[model samples]
Target: MKELLILVVVTIFTLATYYLVEPFAHSQMHKHVESEHFAYNDLPKLTATGDATRGAELVMGGAGCTGCHSIDVAGMPAPMDAVTAAASYGVNPPDLSNAGAVYDAKFLAELIKNPAHALLVEHKFDMDKGQMHPMVAFYGTGGDLDQEVADMVAYLQSIAVKPEELTPAIAYETVCGRCHANHYAKWTQIGTTPTFKYEKESLAFQIQVLEYQDSLVKYMGTLPPDLSIYIRSRGEHYIETFMENPQNYLKGTAMPRVGVNKHAAEQVIEYLKDSGDAKRHEREEVGKYVMIFMVIFAIFAILWKKQVWRDLH
Candidate 1:
């Protein structure tokens, strides 16, 4: 009866500490920034409904998105090759094939209108120092900017593969693949490339990676860390909050508020876990059995001690 009472007290203490004290301490240490603190929250609400057809024409021709980015759908093949595009812009422009599926619509419109503001890196752009973001702001050709942006978004959405069909690779590519590489997953900063069979292909890939890295350093003033082990290093909570608003975590960080919604963020975290901690599930499964064994052994040990001391008592 005494042992049962002690166990109940200990369990209650642990639960109370975990549910109450830990949270209070953590909140005190880290000021909890709400999701509304994200830069995308400041973007004006879109007024015009997007027209996919008009957006397509604008993207391909008037908006000149193909000059930097590749849509990969029917009419909108990449105009410039990856190397040329990377040379022209500091980084290889992401393929817009999944932009609609991956990014928030308002965020995309803001990205088109003001790349620096959309990316939460306006501080890095200084006209005096000649430091500018690689992606230029879209000033549409004397047209209704809102409608044009809406149309472009609609066109991107139209070309997007269904969200349900998006694999981890696709999700990561659209979100983090531009700035970060996952070597463990064989995903490069540019895109996923199959292992090269030929030496020349391998060498070419290395050169491309180097060029991209160099450009990134110039653009951001620092190389973004490889995300291969970030899940293990930083843990999920840090990554999620950092992605939501990097400025909150690291003030004046060149990294942008990625504006990844919770669903997509969860998918990204799952992908990171799969890559960095492949054995986590197996380890957890084994741990459960070990815990059971320990509990059984402890119970038997207590019973044996009671039996041995019965005479003395």
Candidate 2:
């Protein structure tokens, strides 16, 4: 009887060990990103370095990263290029740090590759729609993508994350990726997405009302409305209504309906009001002038390249 009791204890101990260590081990393998409260693991694996330097380059050099995001923005236009800072769709530049820290490499890879479906299966964020970036060029073609996907995974994996300021994949999936992964992934393959984004660098509205910022018609053609001071200038009613049915309000808008409930949308509103959009708007005028120069330079470069090729031939 004593021996039997001893065996039972050992079995229980082993089971406990399996349950606890399995998640950590699984996390190390690249399928899981660890967060403070929960862990999300659904995609393949991620890389160690997220290529933040490359990401920075993409931000510069006509890559137009600063087109639609605000990080420490102040003044009229934020620094960077692409166009004036705008926030047409009531969107904000969701921080990308420590995204992998929420789950694992695999989870992040899937989020980066196919954000729409990936967010749904993972039950991370509760977004009504999905994302529309250029992560995967050929997601819906019904074919295998081993290496190209791996590289994209690596690029996403290379991002450096802040362990302390980590958000759960569940929350991100619910609130973020659900709206754009599919759209952006689709756009990536066909290269049909907009040229510049609508973030900090773009032209932002000095007023924070939830109404469209189309005051200027000349540059407004390809720009989004600003949301920097929405809660302060406009009020909660506009913010909430816009969040609920953005499309009904925007009329043929590229923004998705994330289905932010009253409560959730309120929380987001609070977060936005508390958090500043940075001084990104300060760089706008500089970037716009620079972009014009870049375009001229690009045209000259193309012409020069043609001449060089002809001479060599």
Candidate 3:
């Protein structure tokens, strides 16, 4: 009993020390970002509800979105191929088919109006050098810019895929695939392929990937790392907080605050876990059984000790 009591006390002390010391040590190593630096908190709210039909017209014709982006549902195909688009725009423009589904409405509006400001990347722009964000800002000829933005958002929302239709892979692709590749999941910036049946197709895909990466490097000054192992390396909490406001975590980082709402963020994280820690669910299940077995074994051991030492008391 005395030995057991000492072991329990030591375990408690170790746990207490770990819980206290780790956070303090981490704080010392990394500055804690204030809440003010979180861009989502300062998003411009919509003044009026949007009309989807009007928004569709604006996106298709007035805004000329199809010149750069593709909306398959809207029958707007990409004007340029991936390599050409990347070379021209510093990155291939993402298909807007699922944009409304994955991104927050407010963010979409802001992104259309001022891509740099919306992405918290205005610092990258240099007025003196005439360097601007690749995405051109949209200021509608209409008197009410807010109404036009709202209409476009409404159109996107109307055509967005149903919430249930968004798989983890799709969500990840829509949200992060443009920058980060997940080799484990067979996903790249351009698209996904499980296996290449033809060498020609394989080579073409590789070339496209390289072109996109090169363009991104020119735009952002560094290649974004593959996300295949980030879930395991960075852990969930860190990824979640970092995604909410990347600038807060790494100031001057080209990574934007993507404005993924909670549900979309969860789906993206799920995809990362699926790619990085495929056996997490199995490990958790095994851990539960192991804990139960230990508890049962401890009870039996205590009973056995009492049975063997009843006379000593």
TM-score for each model = 0.84, 0.28, 0.89
Judging by TM-score, tell me the better candidate of 1 and 2: 1
Top TM-score hit: 3
In order of TM-score, best first, we have 3, 1, 2
lDDT of 2 by residue, 1-313 (tens): 9999999999999998997788667557632222211122223544443444444443332234335433222222433221222233222333333233333445444544565444342232233555333222234223234433444334333553444333333233334332222231222111123444666422332122112223222222433433445556655565555554454356554443343333335445554444333234656768999999999999999999999899788
Tens-digit per-residue lDDT, 1-313, candidate 1: 9999999999999998897778778788876655543346677888999999999889888988877787776556776766666667767788888888878788899999988888788888765688777887899978899999999999888888787877777778889988888888888777776678999999988888888788887766788888988998987878877888799889999887776656667778888988899899999999999999999999999999999999998
lDDT of 3 by residue, 1-313 (tens): 9999999999999998997789867878866654432247678888879999999899888988888999988788899987788889877888898888888888899999988888888778754578788888898957589999899999998898878887787688888888888899888877886478999989978988898889988977998899998998987877888888888789899888787766788899999999999999999999999999999999999999999899998
Q: Estimate the overall C-alpha local distance difference test score of candidate 3.
A: 0.85
Whole-model Cα lDDT of every candidate shown, in order: 0.82, 0.41, 0.85
* Superior by TM-score: candidate 1 or candidate 3: 3
Best-fitting candidate, scored by lDDT: 3
- Pairs that clash in candidate 1: none
Q: Which stretches of candidate 3 lie above 4 Å from their native place? A: 33-39, 198-201, 304-313
Clash number for each model? 0, 62, 0
Candidate 1 ranges beyond 4 A from true positions = 1-32, 36-39, 126-132, 198-201
Where does candidate 2 have its weakest 10-residue lDDT segment? 182-191
